[model samples]
Target: EELNMDLFSNCMDTVERCLRDAKMDKSSVHDIVLVGGSTRILKVQQLLKDLFNGKELCKSINPDEAVAYGAA
Candidate 1:
């Protein structure tokens, strides 16, 4: 749990920075498309849910294949 908390903090920072750079608010985000293996972590998923106020994450694309899919 401690490790998860640390990761969550970092994720929060990154999200905040990205939102600020985009000049958008959390409410403006429609979907959270998680990519990469770390995103599959349950703790990460829970943290994101909390961050987004219970918004359902878009998991239609396989996390592992997201990069390849994007390149194609």
Candidate 2:
């Protein structure tokens, strides 16, 4: 539980920082695209859903394949 909490906290921090850097508010974010394997964690997903006020997260692309897809 501790580890999950830490990961969730880190994820929230990163997302918050990104939003701030983009000079946007959470309400302005239309979608949440989670890449990389870490996004598979339930804790991470729950945190994001809560942060986005229950907005559905976009996970259409396989997390493991994201890097290759982006590079192509």
Candidate 3:
């Protein structure tokens, strides 16, 4: 729970910052990408969507296991 809360808090803070800088609301957010394995957690993904107001954050790319695959 602690981890989830932390991730959610940080993600929301970052999103708020970006939105402020870009003069955008959640609707203006083009894409929300997760760059690490920790993103695989359901809590993380759900929190992301919730924070963005059900914007359906993009996960077309890998969130947890794409780096090593490309590092090769």
Q: Which candidate wins on TM-score?
A: 1
- In candidate 2, the residue pairs with backbone N, CA or C atoms under 3 Å apart (3 or more residues apart, or in different chains) clash, namely none
User: What is the per-residue lDDT of model 3 for residues 8-48, given as tens digits with 9 covering 90 to 100?
Assistant: 78876886898899898777667787778778778877878
Which candidate model has the greater TM-score, 1 or 3? 1
Residue-by-residue lDDT tens digits, candidate 1, 1-72: 785687678987898899999999999999899999989988888888988999999899999999999899
lDDT of each: 0.89, 0.87, 0.76
Model 1, C-alpha of 12: deviation from truth (Å): 1.7
TM-score of 1: 0.87
| lDDT agreement of model 1 with the native | 0.89
Pairs in steric clash, model 1 = none
Q: C-alpha displacement of 1 in model 2, angstroms? A: 2.2
Model 2 has an lDDT value of 0.87
> Higher lDDT: candidate 1 or 3?
1
Worst 10 residues of 2 by lDDT: 1-10
